[model samples]
Target chain A: MATFIGMPAFPEASARAVGDAQLRHNLRKATHTIRARRAAVVAEQPDWAGLRAAGAAIKDRTLRHLDVYLERLESAVTAAGGHVHWAEDAAEADRIVVDLVRATGETEVVKVKSMATQEIDLNAALAAAGIRAYETDLAELIVQLGDDLPSHILVPAIHRNRAEIREIFSGRMASWGRPAPEGLTDDPRALAEAARLHLRERFLRAKVGISGANFAVAETGTLVVLESEGNGRMCVTLPETLISVVGIEKIVPTWRDLEVFLQLLPRSSTGERMNPYTSMWTGATEGQEFHLVLVDNGRTSVLADRVGRQALRCIRCSACLNVCPVYERAGGHAYGSVYPGPIGAILTPQLRGLTGPLEESLPYASTLCGACYDVCPVAINIPEVLLDLRAKVVAGDHRAERLAMGAARRVLDHPKWLALAQRSVGRLRRWTPRHLPGPLSAWSDTREVPVPPRESFRDWWARRAGEEGGR
Target chain B: MSSRDRILARVRAALADVPRTETPEDVEVPRAYDRSRSGPDVVELLIDRLVDYRAVVREVTDVVAAVADALARRGAHRVAAPAGVPAAWLGGVQAVRDDPALSAADLDALDGVVTGCAVAVAETGTIVLDCAEDQGRRALTLIPDYHLCVVRRDRIVRTVPEALTRLDPSRPQTWISGPSATSDIELDRVEGVHGPRTLEVLITPAL
Candidate 1:
């Protein structure tokens, strides 16, 4: 619902980001630590490949018949005493959630760290409606307190170091609800304690909770959420009413499919044998009202493209982000979306449909190093989708590139034309400029032009043959 | 048409490539991953994994004595126990029972909670609670700062898949590994967050 409107394209944003020494240092340290942790845990599973394949296959099967699986999920959830709402887009989804919270007569709601809510900008929507939504996850809290946007999916404030976090907490925590303790330190443990004290009162008093699911089962009508802190548990459990906004692509056909994802996700996302907490609920627990909103916001369109549709198989592990060299240096903000990195390069363009310069440039954010594909738990071939998006961008725009390509194709089609052009270039080699004129100079700015030889290879070969015959 | 119908129609139109006759089972999902593990030392393995997550674990022959000793060591005076938990396990502490079902504020006021888990997984060193009578509601074990769970040796399974077979999907479940932790700050692990900061488990011999 909230677009990254007027944000500079990836190159411009990343150009500025690369010059920030503190930002680069923070990104390098965080990503390298997570990458090594993921590698170690992944190696422990001898059948990790099998599990990854199964995870991909399950998602594919569900996506192919998404209509059917969604129908089943709706019916099952209804039977289990939960209400389901269908949203055609972000505006519709936000309207549904705000209406639900309004019906409950609550002005404040506690939140779990959910990407779907972020994608739709739910908190901003609620704020506009005069309701406050508090983010409970540590990283999310840090981002919120600093008045900053999330950079990474798992750790939204990955760009901020411990000292900066301390500054944000000590300076901003009071305005939110609870103030920081007297003289808070930069040590992580102390920072966590301050958050615990601040949010504990809200958790005890909050009447409503909002979340996004890691996996939703069609067969059993279950929703699964994985997290490290007890904040997720408090939000989902202690509240009187719970609302979960989930993407339709998150559905799995059977309950047993969690075995594959519950293994692959933790190892891939946090590099843990298992995260500290995982909560599963079929429907409304005793004394709690439940609502499930199935959002088709830009997902059905993503499902339409055959090559681009694999992006739907993503579980939002952020493994691809951590392993991306381009992401490491350029940082997450440059991509200009709630989602970033290699996955974002392909996903954001498809979700938003190459709407502007920002969307068009996202597909070129990667170096096609294939590290993202190798680390992807669901095994989304990100580079393949990226190349597909790039081709589409070129076909849709770039008039000069199209003209140059057309001319090259015509010359390549005819041998005489190509040879004549080659000889003319060889004769005028000394007059060649190091950089091209006009818009073409953008390509040559960071590269050198090769000097042409005096003669063509074909002419040299023909002369040798004639001299041998003469001898 | 309703938004649901329109969205579903859009989905159907988008999936025009999928043959109409095709069923969900037409796609093959290869599940060759290890489903079950076998060995005699599963209890020992559970202890090793639980300790790896920084949970204090003890293999005790006497459940009652161990539970009491753990509470005493932590100096937990206002300990809470579910109605179904055996009274013998709480002899030494000021055992508060959830007979009327304590409120969130009430649970937060207590020092700790002791409950019996439904199942345990050795590979991940995780414990699951189904909110049965003995385990109480989700908030009982959550609101307090310290949690001491009793895991009978027989309930321990070798792998995650094996553990799933023994539980009911209909019941709300919470799977906990070690204490609450976060790696969000500079990607360094700092244990003890909103959940029980201290997790102590007593693995007793099966009845």
Candidate 2:
């Protein structure tokens, strides 16, 4: 739960990340592959622009009346024999989930890959409560087995190659459950097979399943999950009790609205025409029990800002991450949050509040090339929000900066003082250091200092006038 | 105050800029996207899309013979079929009826599963199962390593929007685009995962 709490600021983290040649290579190769595939598949849809527009508008409409839609969703889910709970923050959400699992009398639960649950740090909470949660997705399994933090939103273990995956499976699969096959190779097929064998037993015996929804239809009270592997199906269907921790923003007002997102998400996320499996269930099915926990967890605070709130429209497609130039070199781990990339740059600071060095530094993480805006399905103006957050940060503390700007304003207000300062800087040109001293070095570390000119423009203009008069 | 009440209040306060007279409908959503198809052959498109996902597709005049042939081709000995599935579809194989609702372990031991789809989308090559009698429970299609689905030509639609209209949201639904696959490894797709690794589709004329 505290994994990202005290991480260093973006500059330090990204500096370290860029130096790791393997990470940069992995990110470049993966992002480029997915980027080309997404472009090709997206091109196949002639109505893609229309779809993108409608997708953005629909999300806007939903957010504008989120209260109304959430009430309707709660009623619909209740009518369908599902229980609904509201959590104000991550701690409350974790407590609710842990209590639910404890009530089920099961010490272990199977899980589908869900960003909401990760944001809440549900796995760590479960472990603290003496309960175990197993991650069923191929990438999640790799991360869980390796005891690693997820780097990418879609591909959690995207940083790890096939060989590293084989090592994790062979070295660590035993204590969890079934061990990897003897002499397992680095082939993806073999690694996937090893995971299949490793987690199959847990899936069959799991009595409780935990998940997050891709979309929640308020009209029919149905929850939809789109995934490539059948592990999502196994987790949601095979378990007797299912708990879904969903962000308040995941709601779409009607079932028909799915047509827009269903077409948009798969192509944008994994570059597939449609993911292999999409499960939609309205509340409890036959012998199963369903619980829907609506988590605020700073989402309401995010919604309070009209300029920053557009970020809530994100469907977690990771398209922005794949297209971001800064993300390709620096990678996901550098962002220091479960959410990463261009979207993360704006989202993390807002959600966590620009309190510490990490949160404050996140807004400046992007180069603002606007690749994220173009690929965004919901059309979240990420750069606009980043600029907005930057203004908010500067307006806040930073006493020295404010004081320096005030002094500069004072000098500029008086023409005589401005001329005197320019003359002094010109005279001191030789003594100017390439890098600034003290705390100011942080700013100059990545930038070059421009040496002062030998003469002021005012002095040069006056001397030229005098020479012309003499002639 | 209750968490729900507080959260709702926060949402209302956040939208103070939005005029009270403006309703949710005030927001405009452009719907010019294609919801239906033109003259292209839908079946051909479905087949092409399915093949693109590495699914094994066969066009047959006789569904029963095709199903039997598909199972035989995989050398599948024990196949699980839902109650609503026609007995003839499993005539050539050792059919395991889901009357008792096979346990997860039992389903895992089976060679494969055969079922009928609610609808198939031509554009996305997706076949949806609503857990109708023929499709049984969701796990029936999962757990097993191989799946042979019977998608009737008449049940195919041209686009995702059209398919959505035909589906009942109340029913628990599973939309299968192809065999279970993953792109998690360096973003390279490798088919066959937790779901049926091999998905074989038999397209036949209306029953």
Candidate 3:
């Protein structure tokens, strides 16, 4: 019901989710299906481990020399007859995209599913600019028509069931492009048919198409997009003007580097050894013009950090999200950003900074279980990043947590001070309420803390030692 | 200043601030090793890998009979041939006429999806599906779960790098390793999650 659970902290958001039986059932089923298939296909290759290592190494090398590769990519694209644009942030990316659409004088466009656009909230911004962006991917169209935010990266509407989708299509599809047939049933095949018919018309009519690339080949100035649906291909080729917004991290050094990724991406993204529709476009074609926008919203900042930079290597494969226990339980909406799983857990905080309660709480969302890291095609050391971010949150940027950790550090720094603190706990234990007062109660709101022991463990240890000595 | 100018300036500044760390890093081309002797067997190796991925291999001595028999076995409801598919190769398939511009639903209804591949790699059991020269658009092999991909043995490469060399510098390319699948927590396997579940390869002998 909420656009995003952006306002609430984890406990609050999780409390709401745990109470929703339907949402839990949907997430449990979807996540389990994808997670199991990914492991099986991944294990089929004895070289999968080697492939993971190579993928991680390639991403590291590229990001480490991101400037050089991006420069090479830009020139290669321009030479191939494509135009390249640079955008600093979401607003700039949105503006550049809007201008590109406007220059063509197109009022509407068919869009391939692009996380970069969603990150910048391009659809909302475009709507405000009087340009309608039509989402061609079925799940994306569902979310767009229902005016919903994407919950998962790969399957954006992973949170919604077929019945909910049917309702959305039956009620909302008309105003968008083509309305659903009357008396649309809850069957998935029916909903898909409705979406296919609706999008096919737009594909034929639209003059411009919008997309985001999964990888950009520097050697050939090629942009790679992988999708299960054929909608992306229709949008990319049928339109006369193709404007693609790709993150700067998408660049790979050469066709050789691209080869590794083409192998790594499919396995990681949709649990496919090879994706159904893999769309790649270079400069302008026979009658089409191509514009590539390299977006660095907060990526450059992310790239500057040695420990946190690994997130830039992500191929946008939602495998990490599907396998994440936290994401499966809390759902993507709880992450408060377009990216709502393990990758989002690390990337979102860094991109937006640990500013609000939402961002700061993200780093602590995981139990450091390392499931995401194991599944990451690039092997981003997620646990290490989480601990590093937690340290930052508890030290400086997150002042409230900083103050608490500072007090704990001081009490533990001196023995007498610690004993005094432990003694006070023994006295306070008797009067300890079932819950803490006011805002502090957030900790005990959903979970209960065991009552403080009558005597500290250290005190008990000393007493046992003394009794033994007397005996 | 226009928004573009402001954005350019900011991007420039951001570039300036980021430390230049590209201190002569190697491209790790993989073929960077032998460097020279990578060309001859590339196509044969690509075919080897495609077959390794469980792609059904059938040599088309006669393009007409081969294409017809492949489609007939599947009892295809429809057949989407690449816009660039050779006239002779698609000359056969009687159940459904060779149509390049079928609807997505119509494409899905078909039992067979056929397209010519750009490159195939031997080491990784993967094939390159690019929109450069032969493959029309990227969707011909995507919508339907059964993909009957054609690979000229000359288009095959021994290593990933050699295959990369075969890809046209101008068109969009799709690299496919194998059929799509996923594994859940209890480790249950599911097929056809996204891509084609059945991959059939038509290995046309080198002319």
Name the candidate that leads on lDDT: 1
TM agreement with the true structure for every prediction: 0.96, 0.95, 0.83
Going through the candidates in order, what is chain B's TM-score? Answer: 0.97, 0.97, 0.73
Candidates sorted by DockQ, best first: 1, 2, 3
TM-score of 2: 0.95
- The lDDT values for all models are 0.93, 0.92, 0.74
lDDT of 1 at B33: 90
TM-score value, chain A, candidate 3: 0.93
Give candidate 3 regions above 4 Å deviation: A1-6, A395-400, A467-471, B1-61, B70-115, B121-149, B153-162, B175-207
lDDT digits (tens) for residues A1-471 of candidate 2? 237767899999999999999888899999999999899999999999999999999999999999999999999999999999999999999999999999999999999999999999999999999999999999999989898889999998989988889889999999888989999999898888888888888999999999999999998999999998889998999999999999999999898899999999999999988999999999888679999999999988899898999999999999999999999999998899999999999999999899899888999998889999999988999999999999898799766666778899999999999899999999999898888887667668888888889888998999999999999
C-alpha lDDT (0 to 100) for residue A67 of candidate 2: 90
The segments of candidate 2 whose C-alpha lies over 4 angstroms from its true place after superposition are: A403-432, A451-471
| The best candidate in terms of DockQ | 1
B175: Cα error in model 2, Å: 0.8
Candidate 3 CAPRI category: acceptable
Candidate 1: stretches off by over 4 Å: A1-3, A415-435, A445-471, B38-40
The lDDT of model 2 is 0.92
The digit string of per-residue lDDT tens for model 1 on B1-207 reads 998999999999999999999999998899989898566599998999899999999999988889889998998989889999988888878988998989888999999999999999998889999988879889999999999999998889988888888888899999999999998899889999899999999999997
Q: Write the per-residue lDDT of candidate 1 for residues A31-129, one digit (tens) a residue.
A: 999999999999987789999999999999999999999999999899899999999999999999999999999999999999999999999899999
Candidate 1: global Cα-lDDT?
0.93
